[model samples]
Target: MELILLCHAATRAMKTGHFPTGDEPPERDARAQLASLHALPDTRVIASPARVARETAAWIADTFEIVPAFDDIDYGRWRGHSIRETGEREPEHVAAWLADPDARSHGGESVAMLAARVAEGFASIDRLDAGRCIVVTHAIVVKVALAHALRLPLASIYGMNFAPLSSTVLERASPADTWTALNFAPYE
Candidate 1:
């Protein structure tokens, strides 16, 4: 099975370094990047329910299944706020969240929770009959999927960068086999 995880296009909140509120639309240039995803015959497309992800998927394909498992990590009170602002207002909370994957001081989903949710998403994808699948989601979701596929620690997410409209490919021989990460690249 082959899986292609594609990050959604850039949004104003993304450019401004604010935690997403799950309602931001793609930036104007997003349409130009639509050419990045070429026509692939017999490919199944799945997307997070977030508006941005859904919109991105719509631009690439006529139809896509909305998957809650691929939803972005909930930011709760930090939503729509810059990371810097959140840190300044709640230094301890920020520090704890960064230091521990289970921390949820922001009253949102923790890193560990996201990892598990992403794992569930992968399992569901594996059950599909399609040989090639594409998932449209957020950068964080892409990072989590990569980390799961590569068997990297959750902390690795902090160091990875997934640009808007970037694609990360993963493949496995079967449902029982371990996944192998193929490549990470942004659509030009």
Candidate 2:
């Protein structure tokens, strides 16, 4: 099975350096940015429940299943705040979160928690008999997926960057086989 994790298009929060609230709509030209993407026949399309993710998926397919496991990490009190602002306001909390995958100092979901959820999401996708699957989700979710597929430490997510509309491909011969990262590229 081949899995394609597609990051959602840019949103106002992304452009302005604010942490996403999971409710922000994609930028006005988001669809235009994804105009080049064409879904292959027999591909199963899935998306996070976030508005941004659903809108991005719509650009690729007329219908897609909403999967809660692919939902963005909860930012809680830090949502809608600029990274710099959050750091300045709660340096200790931010530091803890960056240093520990299980830290939830901001009262939001921890990296470990997100990873678990992403694992569940992938498990369901693996159950599908489709030859290919496209999951439209957030950058963080994409990073988590990559780390999970590669069997890397959760901290590895911090070292990865997945631009909006980018796609990361992973493949496995069967449900019992290990996943392999095939490619990572941004759509032009």
Candidate 3:
């Protein structure tokens, strides 16, 4: 199986460095960038249920399946709040959350929890008969999928970066076996 993980386009939350609250879709420039991608044929498209992801996926394909498991990490009490603001208000919580993948001091999903959710989402996609599957999701979801495919620990999510509309292709060597990332590129 082949997995084409595509990060959704930028939103107002992204620009403001706030925890995404599923408020806005891609900006004009991000729409243009998404339009520049080549057409994908004979592939199944799966998108996160977030508005930003759904809107971005519509630009890439006419039809797609919405998968809630691929939704942005629940920010809970921190939703719509900037990381800087959160840190300033709750320094200890921010520090613990950043330092530990299992921590959920923001009263939201932990990094490990998000990774597990993304893993479940990928597993369902893998069951499909399609040769290739395109997934439009949040940066965190993409990073979690990449870390899972690469067999990296959940903490490694902090080390990776996925720009808006970035693409990361993972090819399975054999059915249900090892997988390798063919290429990881930001939108040009």
Candidate 4:
């Protein structure tokens, strides 16, 4: 079987001299999840190129043997902007984004773009061995992929909470297969 263990995006930029704080995903204990996962024999970690994911992989590199791949949607002009700034400057735009993330922002990627990137990320899974493969990607990427796995409409992605620093195991009988809601967020 093959398992894609999705991880969330950069919850901490540390560039500000402190952890990046926001009303976003959860801030998890990396050490706990790393110590736990009874990962499969052929398990390989694929993480987004983002710093948080990269550093996270570094902590567990020897155990997981990670390879960098996949990235989250680009927020473009909103890249470094915080929620307060965005809300104040672009109320209508923010509302629209909340309503339908699939709608492309002026300079950022739409949900569809993210879905395409995730599709590209999964391209290598089939040719590999049948054991588990853990892919540590962004939160939005996780939602998009899970939505793809569940065959859920892309529009509902923002409504879901794909656990940060968690695993949504996708075990299967064979590589040429698919399923929905295999196992929701399991705590660390």
Among these predicted structures, which one has the highest lDDT? 2
Indicate the TM-score of model 4: 0.79
Compose the digit string of candidate 1's lDDT tens values, residues 1-188: 88899999889998898999998898764756767575476788999999899899988888889999999999878999998989999999999998788999999999899999999998899889988899999988998889898899999998899889999988999988999988898776
Q: What TM-score would you give candidate 3 relative to the actual structure?
A: 0.93
Clashing pairs in 4: none
What are the runs in model 1 whose C-alpha is more than 4 Å off? none
Best by TM-score: 2
Candidate 3, position 111, lDDT:
86
TM-score of each: 0.94, 0.95, 0.93, 0.79
lDDT of 3 by residue, 1-188 (tens): 77888998878788888888886767654656766554468688889999888888888788899998899988779998898999999999988887788999878899899988988987787678887788999988898888988899888888888888889989985666878989999766
Q: What is residue 145's positional error in candidate 2, in angstroms?
A: 0.8
lDDT of 4 at 186: 50
Q: Give the least accurate 10-residue stretch of model 4, judged by summed lDDT.
A: 14-23
How far residue 44's Cα lies from its native spot in candidate 2, in Å, is 0.6
Judged by whole-model lDDT over C-alpha atoms, candidate 1 comes out at 0.89
Q: Model 4, clash count? A: 0
What candidate 4 gets wrong by more than 4 Å, as runs, is 13-29, 38-40, 63-69
Better of 3 and 4 by TM-score: 3
